[model samples]
Target: MAEKRDYYEVLGVGKDASDDDIKKSYRKLARQYHPDVNKAADAEQKFKEVKEAYDVLSDNQKRATYDRYGHVDPNQGFGGGGGGAGDFGGFGDIFDMFFGGGGGRRDPNAPQRGNDLQYTMTIEFKEAVFGKETDIQIPRTETCDTCSGSGAKPGTKPETCTICHGSGQQEVVQNTPFGRIVNRRACTNCSGTGKVIKEKCGTCHGAGKVKKQRKIHVRIPAGVDEGAQIRLSGEGESGVRGGPAGDLYIVIRVKSHEFFERDGDDIYCEVPLTFAQAALGDEIEIPTLTEKVKLKIPAGTQTGTYFRLKGKGVPRLRGYGQGDQHVKVTVVTPTKLSDEQKELLRQFSGTEGEATPQEHHETIFEKMKKAFRGE
Candidate 1:
């Protein structure tokens, strides 16, 4: 009936309207036909149609396809008998643009979210290992307190842009090889805001934002390693036009520990021991992230032997309890010996066994030597 009015006309906009115009008009119509806003019997159907129109018109490629092929089948916008309408940018993009959540332009009339801010924080090894909560002061652009990000002076309000007529864009026709090609671009005078500030806010100089230094406490989670990023939501620079503030990203840098090395969930340390302890066995106290734990050195322990003290390492990042601390033993040789020690070693050498067959620990030569010796 009535040939199902053209989508562009259904939204009451020119065929040559810019993308912003199509979006603005679609938003207005969608809000008007929303079931909650309008109790009309055909509100749902009309809302779907408006959404369909916006979906096709919002994308440059889809709009071009539709412009060339109309509503005819095989038109790229058809989409398996009209099923591909909602697969464009998703409903979130549409909602974010209109509601001021996706970094879009703020309506000189709505509450906006704050802008996201980033800060680099360097922490000591102990603080990152044990966790610390500290406050940092940062200077950023925040919402103006005087005008509340309105960019208007005193009690005045921002007026709609007359050049783009609240569409934030304008069209210009250009001569091309393929006839005339019409293109839309943001208005240069008003910067595509569709509104110009006649009287500016005295506090912010009509920018609707102010620079201020604010202190915010950041919590460093235990087991956070170097280059770890911590996100503090809703703690960034203030938004404009009454928008909410953005998020804060804290990048962590952990200083190296002198005695310990970290490998993921494992804590490693090299413990040095005298040759006497490595040969005769001894209990040595080792340092860990927590308390000092005593480790036993077995007799004949090699220099590279690793001993593990369970649950004595740094805490796991995303799993269970702490990790095991690995202690790598390093044997120290005696550089200077006393005269009594040399005499005692000479006496011990005199009690050594008589001449015997040479034994090879790693080959069949040991068995052959035993056979030649006749036991």
Candidate 2:
């Protein structure tokens, strides 16, 4: 690769320029060289160069390192800054300031990656449990079949820009404390593209791309939770001038289930039991992620007791095996009893010890009294 261009010279602003001045100048140049309006051959290279320049001068730490070492390669960690990790943070602000908002206007000659697309998918509860395959249709940009993304008419090629002489840049010299500083700005006449298209492509109108509907297939892995994102590389919008395509992200939304609630990979459900069943131990069937399982309730089983069924919940999202499902007990009392049943219960209650009744009723009263006292 050729030696990289100087950071100060790339943005066309002076080395001592303030942050606001650099930003303002970059925005102006970006608009001027933007591929949509300017059809120069070197427009894309100029855009990347400006972006790289802003990537460095905007940050305090990176800018300090560059100022001290006079354009030390930050990627090499020569002066003080760390490797590429430091480089991206500086650019992250730039991306947010520009592309982070609503989409910018489209340019035909610009070498831009296709626009990213998002699709919302609703998965059935059962499918969320076991995972499933699905297909979707997305409307996006594709390389123009007729012009092949060149945006120029067939049999015609772009000519060298008369203004910039193919360098796509113009340099201006200014006096500074260090010495005379030379700055690089995108050639105003060529709009940064060293070349200009004489006869535009008829099909794409020199856009080099076209809009079309495409079908994409996605496989959802098992145990995907709500709001999970799946990325489809190179499936987004088409790029201009043979640029790489953008990515497609699928966001999943899980529908609510009638009987179950999820806690991470674990499934929970409440099982109801009649008084008779609670008094006399019985084997009851409960629902699991895969199938039904049997749970045995011991005699005199109390309400709210939880039972764990190992490996019966959802599959682990990050690890192997499945989570344990919990079954909570809720004892049901009869609202109305038959005359004979009422008499039998009264007789049984009479035989029951007074101490048992006092223990239950007194405990509740004490709690109520404490609550009344604002305990």
TM-score of each: 0.61, 0.58
The total of clashing pairs for model 1 equals 10
Weakest 10 consecutive residues of candidate 1 by summed lDDT: 350-359
Cα lDDT tens digits for candidate 2, 1-375 = 677677777777788999998887777766566444468998867766665566567777777877877654546343233224433323334433444233353343457677788988999876777899978999988898887876778998777777767767666655422123344567787677676777888888877677788988899888889999989999999876667899999999999765667888888767666667777778987767666678999988888899999998888767899888888877665555667667767776421111122233344335334423433
lDDT of 2: 0.70
In terms of TM-score, the best-performing candidate is 1
lDDT (0 to 1) per candidate: 0.71, 0.70
Q: Per-residue CA lDDT of candidate 1, range 1-375, in tens?
A: 444457788778998999879878977887678554579999977876776677677778877887777777474644222233333333434444443444555343455677788999999886877799999998888878888777889889778888878767676755422123334568776787777888999999988888889998889989888999999888888875556779899999989766677887788877665656776788976767766667888877988899998987777777779888888886654445566655755665321122222232212333323323432
Q: In terms of lDDT, which candidate is strongest? A: 1
Among residues 3 or more apart in sequence or in different chains, the pairs in candidate 1 whose N, CA or C atoms overlap within 3 Å are 111-242, 111-243, 112-242, 112-243, 112-244, 113-244, 114-244, 114-245, 114-246, 161-194
What TM-score does candidate 1 reach?
A: 0.61
The C-alpha stretches of model 2 lying farther than 4 A from their native spots are 1-115, 169-191, 348-375
Residues forming the 10-long window of minimal summed lDDT in candidate 2: 350-359
How well does candidate 2 match the true structure, expressed as C-alpha RMSD? Answer: 17.2
